[model samples]
Target: MLTIWGRINSHNVKKVVWLGEEMGLAYDRRDVGGPFGMDEAYRTLNPNALIPTIEDDGFVLWESNSILRYLAASHGGEAFYPADAQRRASVERWMDWGFSWADAIRPIFFQLVRTEADKRDAALIERSVARAADLSAILDDVLGRQEWLSGDAFGIGDIPVAAYANTWFQLPVERPSRPNFERWYAALQDRAPFRDVVMIPLS
Candidate 1:
């Protein structure tokens, strides 16, 4: 059985777990990091001590996006990862971009969800929200032309950003209406595995 070491509430971990669910792969996830605390033994598998370190039949891998790519390529075949060089590159491009966007939105998520409202930095939240909206506008424009960030169909590219979008759409901050972005997100919301895995309440 595949063993995933990470807290389920973690956004990064959600990307890997959600992909596993989407692929219908059997795996077990253990709680670590956050309230669970990290174990010294976890470091042997991942020196970084990150929440998600996957041990798959003895092949250990860290990094959430890399795990997504690996599982899709190995188990999902052309349907999930794609084999064509250009098409694969396109998926890779968005996955990179989406992860970058995750870094950009981390502060926004932490301030609103993780931090107490009275103790939160108002100025930082304001600036970050503005920047996030600008970034969302760019994504909305691209998505307006296609059905998925991974191109015509859903794939690994959409996983990273959608994990973050759960936080974005749930935050109490005022956000500009992003029709195209909302349209894509609605479709993601409809998927059974997506709702089962990625739709958890933010921690």
Candidate 2:
């Protein structure tokens, strides 16, 4: 059985948990960050003290995207992860892009969702939101041509990107008109794993 460490509300943790559910893999998840509080023992697994560390048998792993790739490859999720070199590289690129997107949008996310209203940085949030919209436009253009970020089918590439997208829409900021991106997101909403796990209220 796989053992995972992290709180469910975390976007990164939600990515892992949702992917696990998508793969139909049985696993145990232990809450370990964001008020759950990591102990000294947890440090041995991840020096960064980040949410979402996974142990598959004796193999311990951190970094949410890496864990998603590993599980997809190790399990029979090659349909999502892909076996072809070009296809796999495409998925990897989107996963990496998703991480970069998260970095760009996180400041806005923290400002609106995590911080108290009076304490929020309006200027910073405004700038970050602009940047986020610019970034989202790139996804919108790509999604306009394809059904999934990984290509024609839903796959590993969608997980990390969608995880952040979930938060972006849930935030109380004004979003641009992105019909393609909205369509893609609507499809993701129909997935059981996404609905039950990734689509939760942002904390």
Candidate 3:
């Protein structure tokens, strides 16, 4: 059995849980962040004290995206992670891109909606909106031609990006027209795993 330590509301933690569902793996999840206070045991698993550290067969892993990749490679083989070098690299790029975009926009999101309106930073919100718009345009263009980020088939690469996309769409701000991104998101919404893990109301 696998054990995951993290709050369900965390996007990164959601990615791992979503991937597990996609791979048909059942695991135990322990809440340890957000409203849940940190534990000394969790620090041993993840020194940075980040949500979403996993224990599987005595092997512990941190970094949510890396954890997803590990699960895909170890369980689903090339189907999710891919064995071909070029294909694997292509999928890997989306994961990196997801981190970059999330790091840029998450603060804005946290400040704007997660924090009370009176406490919100207006300038930061504007900047976050701009950055999110730019990021969405790039994704909109890529998704316009393909059914999934990695290719025609869904895989590990889609997990992290899609997790972030949920946040992008859920924010209480106007989004630019993104028909392609919308279409891809619609398809993802139909997936049970995505709905189960990634479609929760924003915190």
lDDT of each: 0.90, 0.91, 0.89
* Tens digit per residue, CA lDDT, model 3, 1-203: 99999899899999999999988898999999888979887887789989899999999999998898899989888789889999999999999899878976798769965899899888888888888888889989999888899897999888888998888888778889999999989999999999989999888
**CA lDDT, candidate 3, residue 148:** 93
Per-residue error (Å), model 2, residue 31? 0.4
Deviating ranges (above 4 Å) for candidate 1:
none
lDDT of 2 by residue, 44-147 (tens): 98999998999998999999988998999898456867889998998889999998789878998888878998998889998988988999999999999999
Residue 37, candidate 1: alpha-carbon lDDT = 87
Q: Candidate 1 clashing pairs?
A: none
Per-residue error at 10 for model 2, in Å? 1.0
lDDT of 2 at 182: 95
TM-score of each: 0.97, 0.97, 0.97
- Which stretches in model 2 have alpha-carbon errors above 4 Å? none
Q: Looking at model 3, report the run of 10 residues with the lowest lDDT sum.
A: 104-113
Per-residue lDDT value at 161 in model 2: 93
Looking at candidate 2, what is the lDDT of residue 166?
Answer: 90
Whole-model lDDT for model 2 versus the true structure?
0.91
Model 2, C-alpha of 71: deviation from truth (Å):
0.1
